[model samples]
Target: MNQLPEDPCMQEIQRLRADYEAKRARSNLDSAGDRRCIRLADIPGTISGDILRLKQNLPDSVDHGDHEIIGDKVRPILNPPPPPELDDDSEELDTILASLPIVDVDSSKRFVKKGKYKSEIRNLLECEG
Candidate 1:
């Protein structure tokens, strides 16, 4: 049986889809190139070889031990001797803190007191009666 001809609209849609896909692929590659990170796989063989050669040429006298660069090891903190002036400074600070008024949160006034409003309402009702 003879195949039906593709609709012109469908053909145009397919063409546009193909063009979009091609553009998307190109943009992905372009964005990948824009990234700051350089993958080891992407590095040129000659450049890697040069790096290896440089590492090999480094003198043994220059300790290239990874352990030499001490990592985050747990150690007891050496407490520094307390300064003689520290006691005086702390006493002054304590006096200043004590001088500041201690605010009583319970004594603080609210914008609208419930008891005051209720009394006013009762007074109004008594006057109306």
Candidate 2:
């Protein structure tokens, strides 16, 4: 026996199927050229007016020539050449120097003895006196 759909899910499926069939029919009709075609009579006069307005809005003179000079005769007074490229040996030397391990030195060993400062301060005081 055929039973009627009672659930919301079945109702939604039926609605989607109807919409799909309607779209397919419209597409087929459009492809068959049965739908209304766009004719010159349908175009408004405002389109021609817009084209004339765009042409009038453009600049009168457009300077599109090359501004840069080439060759030996047109030598640049202040322009400088690019820096020379470093050779492979120089690059390797730089990498080797950069990778070297650094040595930490003790500054306390370089400091003058306390007795030496005491004698210098005494001599300065004596000289002032």
Candidate 3:
């Protein structure tokens, strides 16, 4: 009678395959990671739940872990701070205007030549630099 050989390599491969299968199964079921999110049983939290369920599940070579629940509950949409609050942009404008230093305008106009305007601007830029 010929006895089948117990290959260590095959045994190791089987062990790894089993381990992967187990983790994949666990990932599909378990979602209680960091945050406690309300999971819908009907819906799959993961995109590839079906693939994971299949016997030929892809190998976890890419270190692709299951996405954990982000939040405890879905927040209710608030009726965004009254419409008036949004419409009242004048307050912001007023605040900006108030922050600006008041400048006094001299009614007297000393007309400088058009050519002088460029020189004056260049001089002002040079001074600033």
Candidate 4:
């Protein structure tokens, strides 16, 4: 069979195709450690209805010993506790105010004249109010 020579452009394209296939195969092999098959059902909190269904199916008499313990440990991480409440009697506010830089009398007078000192004091106590 007399086969005509392959076109240079077609030869170049075939070579590129082979290179691309090799790279794709290597990429798939390299990504084997990744959770490539993870679905919505596999992720926690992704399907709230399924969780509710599971909870409903479980009998009240059954002890969820390990599950409860795991949930307790995970809950704080998912929903962190609110910061400690600052009351009017809290000394933290006083401590913060005391930590402010102390200016000399002349600068303090200038700040007072421009109402900058009062504004700064008000800003420091704004969160408390």
lDDT of each: 0.35, 0.36, 0.39, 0.38
- Clashing pairs in model 2? none
- Model 4's alpha-carbon lDDT is 0.38
Model 2 root-mean-square deviation: 34.0
Off by over 4 Å in 1: 1-5, 29-129
After TM-score superposition, what is the CA distance of residue 37 in candidate 3 from its true location, in Å?
16
In the range 1-129, model 4's lDDT, one tens digit per residue, is 322337676567668766766656543223334222111122344332332323212222222211211221211133334445675542334545565566555431123433325455668557546
| Winning candidate number (lDDT) | 3
Structural similarity to truth (TM-score) of each candidate: 0.20, 0.20, 0.21, 0.21
**How well does candidate 3 score on lDDT at residue 30?**
43
lDDT of 3 by residue, 1-129 (tens): 222337666567667777876767755344334322222222244433433344332233312332222222223223323223244322224433443355554322222332223445456456757
Per-residue lDDT of 54 in model 4: 38
Residue 44, candidate 4: how far off, in angstroms?
A: 35
Provide the global lDDT of candidate 1 against the true structure: 0.35
**Of models 1 and 3, which has the larger lDDT?**
3
Write down the worst ten-residue block by lDDT for model 4. Answer: 65-74
Candidate 2 accuracy as lDDT: 0.36
